[model samples]
Target: MPDLVIALDVGGSSVKSGVVQADHTVYQRRTTPIDSSGPAESILATLAAIIDGHARTLGKDAVLRGVGLGFPGPFDYAQGVCYIHGVAKYEALYGLHMDAELRARLAWGPKPPIRFRNDAEAAIIGEFCYGAGRSFVRGIGVTLGTGFGSTFVVEGKPQRAGPGVPPNGWLYAESWQGQQADDVFSARGLQARLAAAFGRPLDIPTAAQRARVGDQQLQEVFRRFGADLGAFLYPYARAFDAHVVLILGGIAHAMDLFETAVAQALRLPVRGGALGPDAALLGAAELFFA
Candidate 1:
């Protein structure tokens, strides 16, 4: 029988889950809201139901070893306890026994082997085995979403860092987001810039178009965005000595226009993420497969 594992990446807005073979090739994937208002028990129950729905399709004979989970916030990998939970502005999980209920509802067997990992760290594991971080001993991934986030791989495994810094990786410094990075570079930052500069909301393609056509203001805006990220990311690059740094997200995807400014500002070399949206899904697989 082909061995199978169910994995879920719990994020602030949504939960990304999938089933993968032992080799970590994803066979199925799904996403849903991270509903937390209905008590942690309800959350776990829904999660189990979600997993079971996928499990039935994998077949009963498929040797479904267990489900691996990635939760945002601080976690005690050894103790399986939720510590300082703050992924999406939710406070219900602060002292919750996230693992216990996850096991009870999500892992349903006498010998169930549910494994949990830090969200960002798990991303690194997935990237290493099934995504872009494969060859580099030092792999770093930044999730540039509502916030700038990151994770690292050292010696072919997740290297943990942080109890703070708003979840952005590579550069956790307040300067990266709350202060400068996002304040001047992210999607929201760009929106504000356009509203201020053009007196309206403008998309990237349009902004890039204008910039390419020699629109000085638009060009400078994107340039400043890159420069800020570069400056914020340089210290971490130097500290971790990572050869490949991946920038993942809508903002990071458009690296061509802003990358130079960011690189020049930080005086470091960072590249676009190799995996795209698959990083989180693959990271879910790493929970059990790794």
Candidate 2:
């Protein structure tokens, strides 16, 4: 093990990079919104710059032990390739060799070993190692951000299930069962919910504030969000039998707004994710060392 590690969590909205110590402490963290033309080439340039920037900060003798990158799209981690889901704009990376690319990009200055996983997987790692995941083995991690990204954790182990869709067989579920994961259980979905209900623009903070003050429309909107969350989570409980779904990210933290309906849906088989704020940052370093 080296003295220093750099973990890069690449998200749809932002890219966060930070340095971690052997004792699992995080310092000198930096984040920038993901700004690119949504093409593989452009995104690659952006990512490469972030990586280099972090490496430059760790100093010459710190001994870079490893680098871990979490991408937003479905990925084949075994292949070290990321499949851009039209949103990332990198059709060429579908099976592109990442080890080689990373080596080529940061071949200079005592390169530490590198590892890659889905951004969801990385967040789960964050939860399991040091955040909400510290409690149970059978917890599912869900980041309710721009998109809903989830990982199934069994006894502190996150599924390496890449970007490939699972055999959960959701077609009939969607038609008859009601809510789906990405549509109803995401931040973007929350925004859409407020928009659809009010027939006007509804920012995240504004809606939360009005609802706090007993705004009927906003309260209804939040209640509806809770209901949809319960509906979406029902299937996860049935399919994976997850003990707790460790909630992280911007939307998940605002659990107060949707606690009524969301918690109401928690029955015998399912429960809420207890990982509080800073799960992602904690996981960023913990995943690397673990």
Give the Å error, residue 232, model 1. Answer: 2.0
- Error of model 2, residue 43, in angstroms: 3.4
Q: Which stretches of candidate 2 lie above 4 Å from their native place?
A: 38-42, 59-61, 88-95, 160-179, 238-241, 268-278, 281-288
Q: List, residue by residue over 25-134, the lDDT tens digit for candidate 2.
A: 77777887765446555666677777788887766668677777776565666567766655534555666676667766773566667777766667677767766557
Among all candidates shown, the one with the greatest TM-score:
2
Cα error, residue 107 of model 1, in Å, equals 8.0
Using all chains and alpha carbons, the TM-scores for the candidates as numbered come to 0.79, 0.81
Task: Give each model's whole-structure lDDT.
Answer: 0.67, 0.65
Candidate 1, residue 21: the lDDT equals 82
TM-score between model 1 and native: 0.79
- How far off is model 2, as Cα RMSD? 4.1
In candidate 2, which residue pairs get closer than 3 Å at backbone N, Cα or C atoms, i.e. clash?
A: 74-163, 75-163, 126-283, 137-155
